[model samples]
Target: MSDWEDEAEEPSAGKQRPRAPASTPWMPPQSHKQRSYREEGGDQPPTRERAWEPRGQREGDRGGFRRPEERSWSSRELPRQPETVTGGGWSRDFRRQEANRELASAPLCFRLDSSVVGTVIGRGGSKIRELEESSGSRIKITKGDYDSEVKIFGSSEQQDKAKTMIDDLLERYDERPETDTRFGYKEIRPSRSADMSTTVTAPVKRGINWASLRENREKYEIMKWADLPPMEKNFYKEASNIASMSQDEVTRWRKDNNNIICDDLKEGQKRPIPNPIRNFRDAFDHFPEIMSTIKKVGFDRPTPIQSQAWPIVLQGIDLIGIAQTGTGKTLAYLLPGFIHLDLQPLPKNERLGPGMLVLAPTRELALQVKAECSKYTYKGFKSICIYGGGDRKGQINVVTKGVDIVIATPGRLNDLQMNNFINLKSITYLVLDEADRMLDMGFEPQIMKILIDIRPDRQTIMTSATWPDGVRRLAKSYLKDPLMVYVGTLDLAAVNTVEQRVFIIPEEEKRAFTLHFIDSLKPKDKVLIFVGKKIIVDDLASDFSLQGIAVQSLHGNREQCDREQALDDFKKGIVRILVATDLASRGLDVHDITHVFNFDFPRNIEEYVHRIGRTGRAGRTGESVTLVTRKDWKVASELISILERANQEVPEELFEMAERYKHFKIKKDSERDMIPRQGRWRDNP
Candidate 1:
């Protein structure tokens, strides 16, 4: 039987069944799987199936199952929102916003009952200003023949407040809108609550497209999800439960295997999006402006992620993308956002409230995302990067003035939100990049709060290098029926583009070892040095400088301007080496970084992967050398696995070192006192 078919019909050995509670999350039913399998005429379609599959995949798939510790990142009082609110027209419609969120300045437009429109608007537009000031918002009352659209512009808090005040004012006229007398029809009104305000008033297009009624069912493949019949939504509703991974556990997979799991696939099962277009010419056939902009930037072909991702995103599917850094993941999300905006533009003259939000784990990553956005938005797209340590007034001014895209760190975003510097009510596209790190840094409360405000109508896209319990919990909490895409191995490991080497040396000898290796690198090649602490980063940089090596340091202690300058210098080849803590590991992307030197080997493989990922990105070949000691034996096995996969030689001595700590481990209740193993090494001479 094929992977799509039910193996349970002829099972032998025990296999774990998917155990996630059906009520908490949604998945396509098994009966539908049977039907899909039977209907599919041919054998398993030829596609990119590789290193790892979903956690829930059974015997047929090469599933890597590791039960994460049971823990809740949700230590809050926020009420759990139902997946789909039941039996309320306004409630259902509120969650289903159809506005052009790409326009940051689009106002909240809602229909006010014609009977009470006069009461809310008041004479000579008098009450509008009063309502605006009282709720810290701007209001515009545009009256139609029977109903009026009371447009609101402000922070979500302000809009919610103003909507409430308007609702209370309109309470003076309790009677329903008067029935239309000309048609002899008693008003068969769609039910609506007073407080509800929808951003789009455009009539929803209905009826089947004749284009989809062709021979051989060709139209079914090309039809956009937005234009698909109502039943199509339900068809894709039942998909697999999406989750995340931890930073440790080394698994190296190739990018050529761009497999994506959709609503039609079972758990751990993935199928690449069909008809994957190769270049801009084909992919952007419908997106001419975007195609022109990309061509101007000299992009001839879309990266592996972009080629597969663009088609799915263009279909308006909520996506969870897993691709290595420097693979153009930013453009994968941003380009789609731009295309969506172009296709369904916001009303002209709207104020600047970002319709699309890209949340990154760190300031550096946020800035990078913004920089990439600027390139793609060459068609007069404006964006701002928000993080702490920059000018607060400048951020507030630019954001409030208006921007098409907003890239921000969670902490600074939370700060701006509290001060009413920005509003996310109309945010249609949400991208959470490096989501696991955000949780690792304890930004759960801030992320959760932001989600609460933009709960309904938002299309969320979360991407992370590894899938940890935290990321899994987050995916469960916010996303609905999201499509999970895995370009490489889902397991945590270094990017395949880098050549790796590990040397077992004493801790005190690491300095000399790194210096020896540094002397061998090309003078112009940028080298990144990773240490465990900020003090180590600074001390190493200072020591390297005193030794006549041009090096710079980056960590939390350095001023924002200094950090930016350090990165700038490194990128420009003015600085040859950069010493940094793990802060620069994940999101820091610089092209042509020839080498990554690990002065102090990290305790886990996750840190190792992220550090090396900085070097070999965007199809560039790079090298990573690690100075290991007996203390790092816990990670030695995984490190060996990485070395073996990369076709690099692993010294047999590594096993000898591994035996020292692997067999007789340190006991938690040991009676002996802990002492540092200061290795005896030859002096600097």
Candidate 2:
């Protein structure tokens, strides 16, 4: 007689079923017409009643339905649907039901592997949210266990839709550049407590504390030249002088100076290492195969660095050759590496493995260096680049097989070392090209570790444009009293080929000013824009692209693929303006660059030289424009010193601002009763 008792009741139209109240009552329904009619129709009386029902309620029942003892449903509020809507215009309630149904029916859960989940989620989970909306299904990632599993829930049809969506997403995810998401092992303090099992603490106490650490650290410390001791001071001064001294100056210095040690000639040698390649002219020069390979790669004439470094490297002299970028630095070391390998066969011992170790700061540079090595590696000389951003297992396998030359970045090399894949004991020639930049990027410590791992007696070549303090210290520590062949502070005057200029603009108008400059970039003129920050590189790149400018950006933040593409695009002249950070300014040789713009001035004076040096390269006439704003006057002043030393004229506006700031500085100094240095602006400006 009751709806609860009518479980087997037949449906009449789609009419609502009448039932007892949710709560228990003392009496049954007062209106018995409807129920008595059902009783007259021979419906059986209720066989069971709620246990909490009162006696009066049972008597008043007259076989009518009584309220149940269970909690009432009418007072309870219905659940609110999720705010998110599906792509197919399904309401949140319908979507939730559909998701539940899908989860119930789904045959198997698909998994996606990623070390980074939070990054994939992005801000506000917009990426996943967008995917859900477009797929007409609900996709829910499980709780953050760092597990790769993601749940796709919807109805069977919606589940199928979600699966397809998920599959497509996985494909895109796989196609996306792999991010370096390694947070590394957590640092845990060593604990003696047996109960503290979670902590993996190691006791690192030493007899000496801060002072000892400082003293020991300084023992092997590679500081800038200025921080070196008085006795070690002259070594760098001599090195700087050697670097600055021209080829003729070097010839004179080596002739007169006996205290300096020449790696090849010893104390009294007059000439660079004798050309070993000349003796094997029949093997390399006259031989049609080697000749063709050389010709095809465009080795018409040897560069100064190449000419000097090759013979010494070939002769097995531990020479340190300092040279500017694009001056054949790769070949300076690569040819030596090749010649060294060419002269001798690999030892039978497996430990006597790779003969060459060339370290660069970037994967692109590593790969590029390896590419150069490949050109001359025809005679069973195999070289491989062990760099990140690619398949590491393949590189590991190559290392296992042994290579003639191994070019790699510090981090990947460190990784290889951690995995026990790299054996540097056999490396005979260690070349650190772009040494200064390598030191600048905090690679010195890892590089030192790598050097220490290798045979110390191995030939070491540390090459750079201007030897910074860090580089000098690294050279002093790692390199023996090595042949320090420096090409001196490579100023614009030293490189007469590059023409430079400056444009004074306010700080606020930089983007617009950059846009105007980009518009002026002609088709054959490759342009590189240097920014101080990585984010600005991205922002300007995006802004330029949105304005229909086919520009590419290169920075440390970009994926390796993106960075490569930007470089390729610039190389191909498809993208005229390359927005980049200071990282790209060094060790990158794009000869066709006609314009270099300092979208932001460099942090140091040396970087400005390199950034502008990218243009007017390989003896081509080029232009560099630096937008000097009022705020950048301090940097501008430092830059002017280098320019002045190089005989390049500083902009008149910069000079005037330097003078004005000098007056203001003097005024402030006087107001504070501090005596300012005399002839400051006048001395320079």
| Best of the candidates, lDDT | 1
Model 1 over residues 585-643: C-alpha lDDT tens digits? 97888897899988888756767777888988888899888888777877777777777
The model with the greatest TM-score is 1
Model 2 ranges off by over 4 Å: 1-292, 345-352, 488-494, 644-649, 660-685
lDDT of 2 by residue, 515-567 (tens): 77777766677888899898888888888788888888888877877888889
State residue 168's C-alpha deviation in candidate 2, in Å.
71
TM-score for candidate 2, please give it. 0.57
Predictions in order: lDDT? 0.66, 0.62
Any runs in candidate 1 off by more than 4 Å, and if so which? 1-275, 665-685
- Report RMSD for candidate 1: 32.1
Error of 1 at 27 (Å): 89
